[model samples]
Target: MNTLYRLGQFSIALTFPALAILLAVFGLPAVLLFLSSLNAPDFSLTNYEAFFSRGANVRVLLQTVEVSVIATLMCVIVGYPTAYIFAAASKGLRMALLVLVVIPYLTSFLVRTYAWIVILGDGGLINTLLLELGLISSPIPLIYNRMAVYIGMVHIMLPIMVLPLVSVMVGIDKSLSAAARSMGARPFAAFCRVFFPLSLPGVLSGSLLVFVLCLGFYITPAALGGLGDAMLSTFIAAQVESSFDLARIAASSFVLLGLAAVVLGIFGLDLSGAQDSRPHPAWKSPPDWLRSFGAPTRRVKELAARHRAKRWASTLYQAAGRGHLWKVVGTAFVALVMFYLLFPSVVVIIMSFSAGPSLHFPPRALSLQWYRSFFNNPSWTDAAWISIQIGLAVAVLSTIVGTLAAYGLSRTFPRLRSTLTMTILTPITIPSIVVGIAAYLGLLKVGLIGTKTGIILTHSIGATAYVVVIVSATLANFDRRLELAAKSMRASPLRAFTRVTLPLVRPGIIAGALFAFLHSFDEVVQTSLVSGFSVRTLPLKMWENIRHEIDPTIAAVASMLVLLPVAWLIVFYFTLWRSRPTVSGVPLETAS
Candidate 1:
């Protein structure tokens, strides 16, 4: 019994060191940001007061909320039908569409956002098409407005909505809708009454994710919305980039953090009604006395619709391939949405092969000249090398810390798990612009600003959040018996864990590392704030060129960036697959 107690204590004790480091890394900057906001030659609330007192600040905050709400609604409207079709799709088709969605999702954020500029800018694809068809005298001013912001944001957010919605919809019992139809309900009515409400949890979750991400949007709006349509992040960034007012910047960061918290609340919302364990209120046949005489005409119409649905349902039941008009439309719309999701990446790749010095819709000719330019340019290549180093460093540090934190959380008491989870994700929960300001202020106080070591440490704070989430989830499914078996054979707990547990969860660790690397490699908001002239990363370098309207070379760089992650993803899994043993000491491929 004493040994068993120590064994349990040993598992719990392992979490302490990781938890302490996580606390120091995330907590210190947070405290610093608050103190920085109080800096006004002495400790004071002047910055907070100034941040709130300005009318423009309030208006921008309001505008940010308004745009976020509209964007969330638009994502739902565009994503619902597509999700429905995907949920009902055959296995092959569903897998294919999922890959299409993930390709752009895994691509560079700036690269995709930048492609929209080329497609919508002056004398760009849309305008060229308009000119060719003689629809307008000149460009229609498509690039720098709320319309463009919505288009770019919605295209990016659509997949976020579809993924969650499809997961929920696929689990819904089709029998519920079929039973409703057989009981004289119309197709649309049955769908509305049965499936849509049940899918609300997913809708709410996805909408909230999109809304919070929209709050922190820096690139898409900046590139596409122009100056007049700036987001909250734009103002926050302006404080860092233009004004250098660290106090007000930190204050503004807190304000944006508040709004993001409100959106995260939507994730915790319980709209699915699945928790009501009690049986639903009893139903009985309707009687003439309960029916209102004045509603007779409405009842007649409803009955007619039901009759039509019953006939259609019969047809669908008898012939498996038959589908309704709405289904057909929904499927086609999903295809178009998939194309939209992939379109920007496609445009970047195509333009990478262009021979010209400027961006055009369909290039008159193609060559590898721009690619060669990226290779030959010392400035671009050196910056990329720096980014690669930073990414690797961040990936390693974040993965180690994150894996430990995940282990700690898994061994912690269940009652405390939710609080721990939220605490670990706090860095991600806050807007990046806020984090950037906080990191910049915190690092400067320690004389680490512009240093590679400082930048790598700063990047790891955010990267660790991703690793913790991924590794914790993977650990949730892990079997403890294998480790127990090793322990029963007289192995120490640490040895048991290393020998038995780590191999099974290695994939998750590697995945966490990969994500951390990509995030650090592509990191912009924080890097932009902290980096000096000597510390230009590839993203920062491209950002400078983007503002100056330097094309072609950026297109080539974007194309390579787009494919690099995909290649890494394939190679990582290939190596892992080869390392796994089969039933008779063969690899998986040859075992059969």
Candidate 2:
């Protein structure tokens, strides 16, 4: 057993090159960012002093906390019921709604953010509607405030809140709630006393995730927020563009990192909340009166016997009073939620065909003007190609590195695995703005600024974290006995893994690769910082355009981006859901 273990360990050691490259690219830049804080006059804490000296600077912390808390609370309020829907829905409904939740999530962040601008701008859809209805004489100020920032953040954070909650909620025993209802408890009463408690851990997990991510959020806040409403991310960008003082940049980066670290410490990153503690199953049965709601009032037999065809209308009226109303309301609420999630993408697609400018919805005439404009511009086409190439490279790079790291860590015990997993996800936890600053400073030290190599390296660092998380999840449910059986036949370790384990986990690898590609293509913060004059990608083009003009060309570009990922995702999902093994070209029956 010792010899076998050593051979397996040696095979795992082959993955170290990928790991080492990650350390050099990600780890080294982090070190340089720290060194930047120490580069002030005579190695003193001058930059640190500057940060703390201003009351206004300190307010950014308070403001970040305030916004994060508000956004997190809203996510919980809106997301809790929605997550319940996801976990509790039937198979077909669950698949469709899950896609609804995921598509905008995977859509380009800038494109999604841009959608909000169109809907909330002065000449936007809402304003246009109100003018026609005589609700207001002019457009309401919607898009450039703390409120707008919160809306966009919630839209982005909803899935992050729901996914973890659903994971925890699914494991819950539906029997407990059913049993309570079977006796005499009302549905709401049974849920509050029984179901809600078991789901708290998921709530805690998801709420913490939203809060922490919101603390470091940039894109939405930057796009939608005014100067007074600027989150910490906005200031970080300002510091980056305005100063050659590396220490100032580093100080700002450290503050962002420091806040993130504190958040992780408080929440501990185990959003599932499965490890440490859980709500005790301590609630006893409620009073007899409380249980009465679950028992339907007016027995079914009694009602049928008492009410003849002559009184059928009265019986129908009683049924509506009992439970039919709330059911209708709940279904309507879910529909509205789905529409809100889809609205921005829908608006962006429609606006892409506008014959005139200003990006208002329901244009007078639809035309392919923007599409033609996009194709005709050499700069746009060139940038599109560059983005595609970079995305593909980042995809391959992140997938290989992440899979290797995940395989090595999966071979370890749970405790060590958790620690390493957190380390790998460090890039993700830090603000992207901070990441851009650190990479800019670090690459400058190495004279790699304004280079595609620098952008690729930075993107892979950020992108690798997602691949690791996704692949690691897939490996957790993996069956290891097949590899053991190969080893029992005296197959080489590499052959055992490749010929057995790898094939089983290929779907996960492919999924991770897709995410890596999307991350590379949509990434704006780090790429914008690193690609000074040498490289330009599609996202950079959009970012630059949005800062100056709301051209329909951007909407055309955004629509293309939205359709590409969504189309690929739909194919991938249908393939996965619809796929089945075949025996001699006949599909094997899948027993439900």
Candidate 3:
């Protein structure tokens, strides 16, 4: 009773456990890493100088920037029109299209990357089809090239760009464009002058999200690209494998971090599309000159309107005729975009059941041999089991800690909440390899490395940030009076919270737990660094198999991985979607 009372008195204390874990695991280590890069106590620029002095290092840095810029541009080019169509869609159609976009976004990053490998490999789908059609003599080097790198990257990043754009575009006033049209602007002119400017924030948000994420490109570039296609993250990972040179590694990690920070600073980061949702003024007064000239002209135009009706009616008819054609073109374009996003997964799922020892898109025979191989094999089963245990632990821990932190932040001043929320999000907002290196050093200090405890802790920091975001969004809409009413009825603070507040916020909590589990389950970049090569989670195991051997068993594994997102989507629909009020709690659905 006393403890509950004391806890209720200081709501901010609720954030401590999460903050403590973050500080120990990520924050402190990041500071230490910065110091390590500077050779702290001695404090020299030698390490950084050494890094830039190398021609290969400099080239990789430049290449990372180039690739990220090109990929971001590609996403913008493809995503803008798709988003426009999506926003203009009817409610039911928009909802369905959103689900389609999210399925790939929520799918395992590793699985998606692997699907591209299966499709683009010499023996994979495209090449094989070409050979059968007698269109090509050889595979044409599809898999391991710069072009494949762009294809895989753009596929993975398209949803990130589209989702934000659609969110902003949907909230825009359709009447604004109609108003422009009434002012005698053509449809394209109206869109360019009114709609496009308003959607820039979404574009900025999506582009920042994609570009920063791409700056840290690791798994896809390494898996799909040739040796010359290495990003900074690839270089950093290779250095870690080759040597445990702390200063050099820290220098490289900070350099990558600095690159991300510079981009964020340059473009101005706003992961939350809050600006787009702000209510527009119902009407803005016309300019003095326009108002002065408009009254006489309006009456004159009204009198002349019947005279121009024949020409106007003819224009309307022709416009309506072209509208159907544009509609068909838009529908076809959207269909192609959906195909590009989803076809790879469909390919992998079909190939998973192959009776053959190696990958084949259209297998001569279909069997459950690969599935049986995955289950019966001890190595695969053990890794899966280990991953489950760790995921459960991370989910539970992150949910509790993050929910409390979010609740605390909700009670805080705006500036303090913003600062603390950003602090909590540090693990996830920066590159994974940077976070991984920090986690490794932190865990090393505490002797938790190479254990499930270390991996759980490593996964928890980022997972907790996800939880905070979801729960905070839910709390933003929560009615505080319910808890107060419960307390007024003589219920204790804990009782009021557990009985009233918790139930109201339960949906967000559940969604957060799901996201936390998924975050941990799909993690490989940080897991690999912190595992010290001793622990093997499912993703780690799958990554190993993908890199080392060419086995159809991996197809079975990848197929199962693909289903996880589909399952998550179904669960999300029931929880966040149906719940209505907290629909934004959908994981990564927003850049927020």
Candidate 4:
């Protein structure tokens, strides 16, 4: 008991479990992979040279950056106005709108990508509608193109872009814009000057998040793109399957990693602490320069003076009508964005019930055929059961270790906490394919490859990161005085936590556990690398079916995955309701 108490006093000790697992599974292997890439002890850039010498490899590398940038830009264009509208909305409306955005964000990635295939294929919804209308003689080339790749990627990433933007935008004081307007600034000018500048942090963070995730894309490109549109992830996947060459794979992985790091450095997210929030001088030079509202306000004052002679009542009525028109336009825009985000999932759910042999939207007849096929097939059932078991194990392991780490980090020095936190999050932030390659090398050395244990460990690394971030956000708002009060009453540290701190943060713990499960269940890229074909999780099975055959039965599996998010929301609602007065202040997804 004395030993246990002494160890608990050292907050950093609580992070050991998470750090140990991360090092064994990822950090050490990554170092080895880098060494192998350089032919260590007698290092050379031969592998890198060989990689660049291939013209096809060079093209693919450039193409990956191109696609990621374009997709990120598209997300910003669509997401900015939508998020502005979300911020301006009433509380009830904002929550409803946020739910709409988050549902798609939480949906399975592969399922979302597959939803596009059902909609854009040669015989898909659009083509079928066109043929029925007799607008065209034959199907247009919609699927398997660069355009489809962007459409699918933007669909998947839009919520990620919007959530952070909304979190930041919602926190901006509306009165700042009102103050600008009261100073004779027009609504548009006030927004451009006051609100938009205040929201720049969101834009930087959202775009950075979307761009980095896009860099490591593997499944979406593979599913939606043609041979000419291959990204680096697809290229790396090809190498893994064909050559199994360690140095080449490592070199390619590092190149992709380097691209992501360079972008991250350019944007410069201060992961060690909060961004420096002190306002900068408007006249400051590039990089530190801030936009000035002075010019826009001065111009608006001139316009107001010119219009001062106009009848005040007439001008007021005109402005009211214009406000009504803007509301209508904003409503339509939000509805359209919601449709783009959700229609694919609806199509998949409807198609799952199709009685026909192939996928069809508005299925000619609804039946239980696909669902029946899913259950009757032993392979599918076994794979699902394996995934469930692994998800549960991962959730249990990740929640305990991640919660402890979050608690420990909370008590540690700020600089040390930030540095350790960044290290922990690397698994999720970097390219999935790179993480997979490193995991493959790690498991191979331990002979855990092709085992269920290998897949669980790999999944746990990423899952634990999610748990830590969520719980840390909850902890940030937690009042330490409560715990100190309990300690003053003669309670042990562990007893005080289990009784006082634990109940208050129970909602976050529940959320972290569920996210951990979802992370493990939906995982595919890393799982594919470590599974070695001996253990098949549900995602692996679904991916194989998507690549090898167009199976309607897979739609049944996907439809089930779509419902998982709804279940999560229900669970969260109940958990939060029971634990009223829970932690607030931090937005959950924003921390993620």
Top candidate when judged by lDDT against the true structure: 4
174-244: candidate 3 lDDT, tens digit per residue? 99898887756668878778888788878888999899889888999999999999999999999999988
TM-score of 3: 0.90
For residues 347-383, what per-residue lDDT tens digits would candidate 2 score against the true structure?
8898888887645577678999889999999999999
* Deviation from native of the Cα of residue 253 in model 3, angstroms: 0.6
Give the lowest summed-lDDT range of ten residues in model 4.
583-592
What TM-score would every model get versus the actual structure?
0.86, 0.87, 0.90, 0.93
Ranking 3 against 4 by TM-score, winner:
4
Candidate 2, residue 115: Cα displacement in angstroms equals 0.6
RMSD of 1: 4.8
Give candidate 3's whole-model lDDT: 0.88
Report how far residue 153 has shifted in candidate 4, in Å: 0.2
Deviating ranges (above 4 Å) for candidate 2: 1-7, 10-18, 38-45, 182-186, 271-323, 579-592
Q: What number of clashing residue pairs does each candidate have, in the order they appear?
A: 0, 3, 0, 0
- Candidate 2: how many backbone clashes? 3
Model 2 residue 172 CA deviation (Å) reads 1.0
Best candidate according to TM-score: 4
Ranking by lDDT: 4, 3, 2, 1
Residue 425's C-alpha lDDT in candidate 2? 73
Residues 24-133, model 4: lDDT tens digits: 99999999999999989799999999999999999999999999999999999999999999999998999999989989988999999989988898888899999999
